[model samples]
Target: MDAQLKHGLLEVCVLTALYKEDSYGYRIIKDTSPFIKISESTLYPILRRLESGNYLSVYSVEHNGRLRKYYKITDLGKKKIEEFLDGWDEVMNIHNYIVTETRRNENE
Candidate 1:
């Protein structure tokens, strides 16, 4: 995947991960791993950006002998997800156009 595209989608993926439940950094990466290629370094910045934007909230909990930071989606985050979903139609339309055009060229 293109680096720019991957970066763009990472934010949404992280938000989606937190949509259902609050999760620590490693857990979020694990959840998103099945779909997107993300690592701790990449994910921490995304989490920070979301929290800075008020799209997510963070809290710390004691687990084992250390503190684990967990992220939860905020109302703003939900709205951001909705906005992405709404824009998906346009992206799909562009993808379909590209596919159709490519097939046409292949046939010709």
Candidate 2:
């Protein structure tokens, strides 16, 4: 996958992970892993970028005698998810076109 495209998808995936409930770093990775493989190294930067963009909010909670950061999707983040869903048809159209083009030679 293109790094830029993957980067955007990863950001959205992280937001989706927090859609239902706020979560810590490890849980976010575990939750998102089913849809897309994400390592700790990859997750932290996405988290930071999302936080910086005001798409999500971060708060520290006491867990196991330590502070663990939990991320919650903000209104903007939720809106972003809705927007992505709205634009999904366009993505699917592009995907369908690519698939057809790739298989055209085989069909010939």
Candidate 3:
């Protein structure tokens, strides 16, 4: 996968995951891992960035006597998701066009 593509999609993916429900850091990592291999260290920084940017809010919750920080998308985050969706559609369309053309040429 392209590094630029991964970087572009990471924020959208995180926000989309939270769109499903509020989740702790670990759960976010687990859920996204199947689709994208994300290191905990890398994910933590992105979470921090999103929180700092006001795209997400975090709160502490006690589970099994351990305090975990859960992240929830803010209204601003929802707006960002909308913007990303638009960008995602454009990127996918371009990618599909390029791939389809390549396949057609290969069949010639």
Candidate 4:
């Protein structure tokens, strides 16, 4: 996948992950890795950006005797999700049309 595409999609994936419930940094990394190739370094900056944007909020909780920061989506995050969904729909539609047209032309 293109780096740009990965960067663009990461935020959407992160927000969606948090939509169900709050999660800590490591857990988020673990969950997202299977779906998207993300680095721990890359994810921290994105998390910071989201928190600064008020799309997500974080608080620390002790788990396994370690202080872990848990993130949850805010109302702004929900709005962002809606926006991402609309954008994804458009991207998919365009991709499908192009692929279909290409196949049709090839068959001619």
Model 2: number of clashes? Answer: 0
Best by lDDT: 1
lDDT of 4 by residue, 1-108 (tens): 999988988988898889999998778888888899778899989999999999999999987998889999999999999998878788999999999999999999
Give me the displacement of residue 6 in model 2, in angstroms.
Answer: 2.3
- Kindly indicate the candidate among 1 and 3 with the higher lDDT: 1
What would the per-residue lDDT of candidate 3 be over residues 1-108, giving only the tens digit for each residue? 999889867887888889978998888889998998778888888898999999999999999998989999999999999998778788899999999999999999
- lDDT string, candidate 2, 3-104, tens digits: 888887998999999999999999988888878989999998888899999999999999899999999999999999999999999999999999999899
Question: How high is the lDDT of residue 72 in model 4?
Answer: 95
- Whole-model Cα lDDT per candidate? 0.93, 0.92, 0.89, 0.91
Candidate closest to the true structure, highest TM-score: 1
Q: Order of all candidates by TM-score, from best down to worst?
A: 1, 2, 4, 3
Pairs that collide in candidate 3 are none
Worst 10 residues of 2 by lDDT: 1-10
Each prediction's TM-score versus the true structure: 0.94, 0.91, 0.84, 0.86
Candidate 1 lDDT (Cα, 0 to 1) = 0.93
Off by over 4 Å in 4: 100-108
* Model 1 per-residue lDDT tens digits across residues 1-108: 999989989999999999999988998988989999898899878988999999999999999999988898999999999999999999999999999999999999
Candidate 3 — worst ten consecutive residues by lDDT sum?
A: 7-16
Backbone clash total, candidate 1: 0
Regions more than 4 Å wrong, model 3: 100-108
